[model samples]
Target: MGSDFYQQSILPFAGIIIKICRAYTHSQEDFEDYYQEVCLQIWRSRDNFNAESKWSTWIYKVALNVCLTHLKQRKKGEQQFVSDALPDEVHDDAKAFGSDELNLLYNAIKHLSEIDRAVILLYLEEKSYAEIGEIIGANTNSIGVRITRIKERLNKFIQAQE
Candidate 1:
């Protein structure tokens, strides 16, 4: 991507992409791969974004979709090797959440079904149920219900860890 495009289009929303990528990836390497792929896809598909929604929303949708697609294409029944190092973009945000807590949360999130994972990630990012519903193709009511269930599941997972 050109410096101008990155500056004008991708730079402002890089955090959104990194956050979504972190949720969907297991290791720093995987996160980097997904992040690069998302950037490329965004540049390639910029024409499809018609300003119907916020740029952040479009980026979120694209990043989640790309990560989900990458996960599906990987071979099944294999372990995801995690590393301690966080990408620079994610490090500051992860610190805000507390690394251990964020690790536990993201690890729990990884177990959710793809769509449920997307919903919960958006919810964590403080997106409204209506906005998350629009991105994930669910209604607001369903987004709320799914988020409740996802939280219950996550609580159980965290408790089990403790």
Candidate 2:
């Protein structure tokens, strides 16, 4: 990766990448691996971006795809990484409630279907349905419906934990 490219392009969007990595990975090591891979992919695929959307949107689309691909490759029943750190992107109230609650939330999030996980993550980031649809290749209406279902499922999961 060119230094100028890293400085000018990737660095500005690293936080979004890191947050996505944290949401998808189980442990610190996995988070680091995903973060590195996403950054590398961004650099490697930089030329593929056609400037059809905001750079951040393209970065988010790439990051989510990478994480989803990595998750699918892991063997079922294999060990997953877990930690008490607050998930990287969430409301400040989540931070104030403490890491234990956040950990519980993360655990619940992990139980969701992969697409639902993506939907919820984007929702948490406050992306509009149209933006999410563009990133994930779903229609805006489907994204809305999925978000409703994901919220209901997450609520049930959290309540069951209590």
Candidate 3:
């Protein structure tokens, strides 16, 4: 909850939170909301962490769970809102990466099922199958199989965009 704790502990993993939030939200407002909620949850749940996993892995689990729950809540309400502008953070991310291909890949990723998006994002982050499995509560072998299928779907999606 303290700024020092955030600065030293949570801020280091902000990129992971940003990526998960972006995957779950379509607009900047929603993105900010999701991002804030994730951070808040991390702070609130800080004591719940038992150190059974690395801090980064615990962060991943928290971020993914927060986003997935937020997505489900939004779906239940089902209000449609469109925004013409991208989030500043997203634009900055694209610029930071220096590639439109990353944007294309993100667009394709948005089309995936929520769980698949998490899997691919973790895989893209170069997380080991065991780490991803530990985060998502799935078997490592299934994570591998799911990643293969998710990659195929993402490929189809990107190809269709061409």
Q: What TM-score does each of the candidates earn?
A: 0.86, 0.80, 0.87
Residue range 14-45, candidate 3, lDDT tens digits:
78888898888886678777777787899999
* Candidate 3 regions with alpha-carbon error over 4 angstroms: 78-99
**lDDT of candidate 2 over 75-149, digit per residue (tens):** 554434433443343234323424788788878888887777777878888999998999889999888889988
Off by over 4 Å in 1: 76-98
User: What local distance difference test score does each model get?
Assistant: 0.81, 0.78, 0.83
Q: What order do you get sorting by TM-score, best first?
A: 3, 1, 2
Q: Candidate 1's residue-wise lDDT over 1-162, tens digit each? A: 687887788877877888788888787678777877888889999899999999989998889888888888764654344333543654565455447877888899888888888988899889998899889988788877788999999999999997
Superposed Cα deviation of residue 19, candidate 1 (Å): 1.4
Best-matching candidate per TM-score: 3
Q: Give the candidate order by descending lDDT.
A: 3, 1, 2
Q: Which residue pairs does candidate 1 place in steric collision?
A: none
Please give the RMSD to the true structure for each candidate, in Å. 3.9, 5.2, 3.9
RMSD of 1: 3.9
lDDT of 1: 0.81
Candidate 2 — which residues are off by over 4 angstroms? Answer: 76-98
Cα displacement (Å) at residue 84, model 3: 19
